[model samples]
Target: MRTNYEAHDIPYRRKKAAGWPGWNSAEEVHDCIQTLNGLLEPLEVASTADVCEIGCGAGNLTDTLADRGWSVTGVDVSNVAIHWARERCRQQNVTFLRGNICERELFAPASFDLIIDGLCLHCIIGEDRDRVISNLSYWLKPGGRIVVFTMCGEPKGKDRAGYDPKSRCAFSGDIAVRYFAKAEEIIDEFRKESLQCTFQQVVDPPNEQASLRALFEKPR
Candidate 1:
C-alpha cells in the first residue's frame, strides 16, 4: 500500500492536474468541507480547534481548515505526498507529517479535537481497517468527532468490474487496492470503539461510483 501510494504521489506532484482517482477536479473536496461545516455547528467545535487529517494527500482540505484559523495536522504514508502537502499549505497553523495510520505511535492518545479520514480509510484493507479506526478514536479528545469520506456499498461501472465481493476490495488487475465496505458495517465498527454516529449519508450516483460520508462523535 505504501509503495503504491508513493508511486501515485510522484506524478501528482509533478503535474498537479490529475485530481484524484475517482474524481474529476483537484478541488473536488467540497463534500468533505461541507460535511465538516455541518458538524461544527452541532458539535460546537472551537475556532482554533486542533484537527488531524489522515491521508491528507497534497493537503487540499487541510489548507482550507488552516485558513479558517484551525490548527491542522496532515498525515500521509507517502513522503512525496507529504512534501507536496507541506508546500501547498505553508501556513504555520498547518503541519504535514508522513506516517501510516496503522502505527499506534503516529500520534499521542487524545491528540486531536477532531480527525478527518480524508477519503483514505477505504484504501486500507483487512484487520488494518479496525486498527485504523481504533487509532482514530484513540487520537481524539473526549468530546472530539471523526469525519469520514469513503467508498461504500457496491461499486458501479468499471469499479464493479474490478470488485471482489468476498474481500470487499476493488482490484487493479490482480492487485487488491480499495475496499468498498457496507455503510452499516462501518458504523458498527465505530460503535465497537464507542464512537456514536451523529450523521450519515451515502451518495450513490447513477452509473457512477458510490461513497459514504459520515460523522462520529466521542462522548465527553
Candidate 2:
C-alpha cells in the first residue's frame, strides 16, 4: 500500500547523521521520558505492566520504560528506526518491530495495557487515522490507556506547509508530520469511539514550540 507518508524511506545513514532532535541529546531524551512517566503516573497502573509505544523513534522511551520495570514494545514504520531501537535498547524486557498502524492486522487484539503514540498520529491522514484509532482501541484490553502527543492547531496556528488540504494530511518532509486538530475535536473523536478521555495538557517545547497531550481510556 503506497501512501503519501514516505518520510520513513530516508536512508539510515542520513537519519543517523542528521540525528533528529528528539533522539540526539540525552537531556532531551530524558525530558521526554520524564514527561511520559509523569503522564502515566496518574493512570494508576501497576508497577509491572506491558507498555507499547507506537512510532517510538529510536526506542528512547521504550528503553527508559523497560529500565523502570515495564515490559515494553516499540513499533515504527521506519526500518532504520526499528533497527536503531532494537540495537540501542538491547534489553530483555524491550522488543522493537517495524509496522504501520494503518495495517491493523499486524497486531493482535487486546494485547496491550498501555499504548503511547508520541507525535505519530498526525502523520496519518483521514481514513488511515480512523483505522489506526479503531485498531488501537480494539487491541487494548478493557481498562487500558492510550496517550497521544501531537502539534495541535488551536492556540498555535496551523502548519500550512505540513498540511495538505486535498489529502488532509501532512507531507513527507525530511521527517513527515501532520497538523493535529483542536482539543475539542480530539475529545469528540474519543467520545465517538466510546473512549473516556481523562486528561488534556498543553506542553511548550524549549524553543517555544507547542504540543497537545491527551490521555484516554477504554471503559472496563
Candidate 3:
C-alpha cells in the first residue's frame, strides 16, 4: 500500500480520474472537494470541533477541515504521505502524524469530536478490520461522529477480476489488498462497538463497485 501511494503525487482524486502521477482536470478536483464538503455540511458541526482524519494522505481532506476553522490531526502509515501532508497543510490548527492506527494508540480516549476514515478502512483486511474499528470507537469523544467512506459489497471492474469470495477481499497477485462487505455488515460492525448509525449512502458508480458513506456516532 505504501509503495503504491508513494509513487502517487496527490492523495484525493475524483473517482473517475486516472491514477496518481496523472493530473485530474480542474473540474474533477472541484467535484472532489465538493464531495468532502457535502459530507460535513449536513452535520452542522461547530468550527471549534477537534477532528482526526485516519489515512489522511497528502492532507487533502485535512486541509478542507482546517480551512473551515476546525483543529485537525492527520494520521497515515506512509512516511512519504505524511511528509507531503505537512508540507501542504501549514496551518497552525493542523498536525500530521505518521503511524498505523491499527498498530498503536494514536490518541487518548474521548479525544476527538469527529473522525474521518479518509477512505482507508476498506484497505484493512482480516481481524485487523475489527481491531481498527474498535480503536476508532475508543478514540471518539462522547457523542462524537465518524465519517466513513469505503468500498462495499461485491467488487467490480479489475477488482472483480481478482475478487476472493472466501476472504471477501480483492487481490493483486495473491496479495489481499482490499476488503468488500455488504453495507449492512459494515453498519453491524460499528454498532457492535457501540456506535449508532445516523446516516447512510451507498453509491454504485458506472463500471465500478459500490461505496458506502455513513456517519456513525458514539453515544453520549
Candidate 4:
C-alpha cells in the first residue's frame, strides 16, 4: 500500500514557482474555476461572508474566491504551499494557514459560511481520511456550504498513468493511490450527519480523468 506522503508528493509551491501549469494543466484549472463559479451562481452568498478553503495548495481557488469579494481563509498541509499562497494571493481579505485538516483549530465553531475542498480528499486514506470528514462538522457554521471536488467511484484504467482504485476501502489500492468516492456515498454520509446535498455533478476531462463535484449544506 502507498503512504499518504507518497500520494501527496510534489510541493505545490515548487510546481507553481516553476510554472508547472498545476496538477493537470492550465485548461483543467480554468475549467474547474469556470464550472465551480457557474455552480455557485445562484447561491447568493453575501460579500461579507467568510470563506474557508481546505487544502488550498498555492491558493489557486482561494485567490479566485477572494476576487469574488469573500473574506477567504485557505489552509493546507504544506508550509511551502502556505508561504506560496500568501505571496501569490496578496488580497487583503485573504489569509493562508498551514495545518493538517484533521487537527486544525484556528477557527472557532460556526465560523465559515463556505468551505472549499478541492481535489485534496483523494490523496488521503485510512483513519486520517475519516478524521478529516468528521472534522468538517466542527468547522462549518449551521446552514453553511461545502464544495467538494474529487475523483469518482469509477474503475481506473490500467493504461492510464493515474493512480489505481482498490476494492473494499479506497485505501487498499496502493501507496500512490488516489482515493475515490461515489456521489451517493458522499451524499449518504452527509445525510446521516444531518447535511443535505444541494448539487452534484460528474465532470470528465478530455484526458478521461473523471471527477465528481458536489455542493452540500449543513442544516441551521
Q: Give the winner by TM-score.
A: 1
Q: How many clashes in each structure?
A: 0, 0, 0, 3
Off by over 4 Å in 2: 19-27, 154-169, 172-177, 204-207
Could you give candidate 3's per-residue lDDT for residues 39-96 as a string of tens digits?
A: 7888978889999988887777788789989889998877767776787679999999
**Error of model 4, residue 148, in angstroms:** 1.6
Q: Write the residue-wise lDDT of candidate 2 on 17-97 in tens digits.
A: 776533436676776777777887777777677888998878878777788777888988887788787777789988888
Give the CA lDDT, 0 to 100, for residue 139 in model 1. Answer: 94
Candidate no. 4 TM-score:
0.84
Name the TM-score of candidate 2.
0.84
Evaluation by lDDT, superior candidate among 2 and 3:
3
For candidate 1, the lDDT comes to 0.79
Q: Rate the local accuracy (lDDT) of all candidates.
A: 0.79, 0.73, 0.78, 0.73
Model 1 TM-score is 0.87
- Collision pairs in model 3: none
**Which parts of model 3 have CA positions greater than 4 angstroms off?**
1-29
For model 1, the run of ten residues with the poorest summed lDDT: 18-27
